[model samples]
Target: MPVPAPTLAAPGESTTPVLAAATDVTKSFGRAKALNGLSLSINAGEAVGLLGPNGAGKSTLISLLCGLRRPDAGSVEMFGRNPLDPKSRLQLGITPQATSVPQTLKLRETVDFVAAHYPEPTPTAELLVRFGLADMADKQCGALSGGQQRRLLVALALVGRPRLVVLDEPTTGLDVDARETLWQQLRDYRSQGGTLLITSHYLEEIQALASRVVVVDRGTVIADGSVDDIRSHVAISKVTLEARCRRRPSTLGRTRSARPLRAPERPPWSPRTPTRRCAGWSATASNSAASKSTPPPSRKPSWHSPAIRKPPRP
Candidate 1:
């Protein structure tokens, strides 16, 4: 069935212009539904982050917003027109999750090709230099490293100086320095009034770049708000104490028994602190055999871990 157009802005909402929107959109592939009544909006001059776990419908939603795929139900709009309309996409740019480029074309030629499509494209020289691709302008696309190719893809997205840009995992394979460079460039882009919709597995990346975060799960939005608001709503409270103790102190084992401890390193050593109890807590040596055999609990944070350990409020 044909979907109806979305209203310009919801009642009692901020009047900022909405550059793109998905209204109660749904999509399905065979028996697996990718989206279920999911709705989102991107306002002008805003940097929004889309976050979700694998198979949470984020990619499907992006496809709908970019006109790469039509939704099974509901509507998607870009610049107040149907996204499938070519005219509506002229001011939009996108970097898909998978990266590919013409193997036979030199980096410069590729940039020139994409720029030619826009009436007022950004200068090729400036785009290359800003993305650190100037030195490799003559290199063929096939000869570029994965990181370089990723950077080139991003640079191409901006070649047209788009009003709205959508990036998916923009820094996936980049090292720390290169990641920082891209972050700074994105910040500068937002400062200049360009709107952004970014999806990244890196929570820190989202925190660093987006003023608003949208979290999706079960094919729908579960949370949406500012970074701090999201954090405060879903974050787990963690408290740590620094104490020097020789060997695995009985008190330390008791503390671990009281509550889980996610320590990264072995506890420090000090003979006098074996039974040490800090000011706020009490530590008593237990003679129970189970206490003697208790091991210190430890965990290390990794990129693959959940963005927030605590469960979301109902």
Candidate 2:
């Protein structure tokens, strides 16, 4: 269930400065609506997680915040100015969901190129080492593995030392160790008062880095609250049962029988069994064991899956 919206501040009321905001925004592409009256705000020094299932408006909102696209209605602001204004974006950094660098450029060159855009960028050597790409600095971008490229993309985003960092699925292709490393770096960034707006499919990732969460679904803001609040609304209940028997039951042979056992008339040892049976109880047991031993069918590669054939438009 969606949580109630927070109370609004009255005009002239002092409040935390908003670093980024999208007010009653609506955007459409062709006949598809990507965002519909979605409103969100990021205050200074916040770590906000934007989450939803595939085709949600998470990416569309990020693009608007970064000035890559404009809203068809309403407004998007960054640092109290239009996001398209160069001054407003000077303190901004972004890592999009799908990224590609010039394949011909070497890793070190790529980092240097991006760093040159900012007035006070992190040293290229330091940035490369920090992301564990020091050894691969001389390799061409094309030669790097998917995980390496992902790491490089994140490293470039931070090279500018921007006050606000927006990341879209930043750890998509990363392994467990690499993902943990990135998370630690982000935590440190937040410690230094850097505001962050991140979207990721991994719920645990959001729980680890974000204090607040904003859920988008069907091109609208469905829920917005602290992590605890969101968890309370969506938390699942689980029950576990454990039973013990003194010894193997003598009626093991009747396990596959179709007969139903009435609790009042039958001993607990002779529990109800399946309505269907194999040739014999022993044979059924053997078949079940064999099935357990068999390996599961191999899954097709992600690219072959229809669900992920292309990055979701939303």
Best by TM-score: 1
Q: Rate the local accuracy (lDDT) of all candidates.
A: 0.69, 0.68
State the lDDT at 228 in candidate 2: 57
Give me the candidate number with maximum lDDT. 1
Where does the lowest 10-residue lDDT sum fall in candidate 2? 237-246
TM-score of 1: 0.74
TM-score of each: 0.74, 0.71
Whole-model lDDT, model 2: 0.68
What is the number of backbone collisions in each predicted candidate, taken in the order shown?
3, 0
Give the range of the ten consecutive residues with the poorest summed lDDT in model 1: 279-288
lDDT of 1 at 116: 90
193: Cα error in model 1, Å: 0.8
lDDT of 1 at 200: 73
Off by over 4 Å in 1: 1-12, 236-314
